[model samples]
Target: MSIIVRDFQPADAEAAAETKRAAIPYLVLTPELVAWQVTHAPGNQRHRLLVAEVDGQVVGSASTGIFAESSKPGQAFVNLSVAPDARGRGAGTALLTTAEGYLTGLGASTAYAWVLDDEASTGFAQRHGYQRSRSSYFSRLDLAAIALPSLPPLPEGARLRTAADFADDPRPLYDLDVEAAADEPGDVDSDAMNYEDWLALYWHRPDLDRDLTSVVVMDGMAVAFSVAQTDRRGRYWSGMTGTRRAYRNRGLAKQAKADSLRRARLAGCSEAFTGNDAENAPMLAINGWFGYQVAAREWRYLRNLTD
Candidate 1:
């Protein structure tokens, strides 16, 4: 009954994703997506995925990487998960230790992690010398049960388009993403400055459902969008829903989300999920209007490696 932590292998994709799903059901994870994350990560991110095996069976996983998009230096993150049935073992501690060592080797001065807002989870983080920081809410909506709001009539010159419409030229969407992400609340500031990096790390992600991702276009410009990710397994996730700063208060964000939700339902998605920073009141209110209820909360924990 020995637990060993090692670098994740391609063959472990399914077992790794299953472990993550059992530990955090709200996430939309699949073997293909997991493999994409490990194999196609941006060079600057220094990403590494680790798996914990107990008696030759994978039971937990951890993902660690530097926040390449953040303007701040030395910022890194580690997300660890252990299957429910595998708890009470030392797998989690081993995984965390290995992840931290890897991040340290990458010159990371600070490490951040998201821990479920519960006694056991928080206690484990605290025991590891991590302090609670900002919190985020995970919300889920029953697409099959809730009646989606009708899409608002677009402004005189505005039209709704799917992300696929930008397959030939995604620069417009990239610009909008950069603008919206800069305004998002978070501990580390992210700029999404490099288009090529964005393409590899986000736009080209295997889980991104371009057909379901709705974009708002006014005249000849892309103003807002709701990025959607689906597993075609009856689950849908709102990756990002934002309106350019210039177009705020025009209901563009809401419209984009509405259109995306309708598309998801029409595509046979049963459940929809999203997450928001606790301080993001406007987005939270918008999600509430869509009938998304808070399913869980996680507190961001940080530790200074130099401490």
Candidate 2:
């Protein structure tokens, strides 16, 4: 069988998305979202999606790009996935090598990738000189069946509202997102400034559930929020949960998350998943309090692109 790896075309979005779903089940992926990512990713992101084909059937995919949002320069990411049924082939290695070369040429000095916490995946990364780093687990809760925490009454002078409530002006949402992202723990930085981009890429994205995305408003400003995403099948995921610095220690984050989760359950969503960096002790503690258990783990592996 002739095998080839090449840049992803618009036509390949569906197959590439399917490959990603097979490789990383925890991620809530859809063809429309995949295509939107390709079309809306900032030019600075240096984003490129690639596919591996064997005898004309796509069997693997890789997302290679610079972490432009990151404050640090020279940092990039190359994540590759091979279909479970197609793993024996060289598609994975081919995709990885090609993606690495592409990012390296783009001036990336260090590239990080996520590999499943399994023997074969870990072995592949180790053999490629990638060092394993912190690992994070994906957890899922039965939103429809599980008993959600009793949401506390909105604190005095504070009110809960959906993202949709700010339809006329999303700047508050943007500000909240930026502040929360700045506090998030991760290898790469995330600086979200362009409101138009966030609108196109996030607000208008197919998965974002604005109705279920709860925000805490105190007086006249948004202070805390929990972004929610629901799949085509009603499966829910906590896209992000954060509280602004000025409002921290007030338990607002917990309130927003609880309200969002409760809303998701009422919306017929059975499963709710969320991810947390292992180093994020506060968020982890909050999720644990909500009875979210670890379902799967992924380790970040980094390789010096120049080497």
Most TM-score-accurate candidate: 1
lDDT by residue for model 1 over 205-299, one digit each (tens)? 99999999999999688999999999889999999999889899999999999999999999999999999999999999999999999999999
RMSD of each: 0.9, 1.5
Model 2 lDDT per residue over 1-307, tens place: 8789998888988898898889888888888888878788878888998899999999999888987666678989999999899996788889988998898788899999988999989999999899988888798776666776676687799999999999899899988888888878877768744676667657888889999999999978999999998875777888889998989988999999998888887888888889988898999888988888888989999998777
- Colliding pairs, model 2: none
Give the clashing residue pairs of candidate 1, or none: none
Worst 10 residues of 1 by lDDT: 148-157
TM-scores of all predicted structures: 0.98, 0.95
Q: How displaced is residue 288 in candidate 2, in Å?
A: 1.9
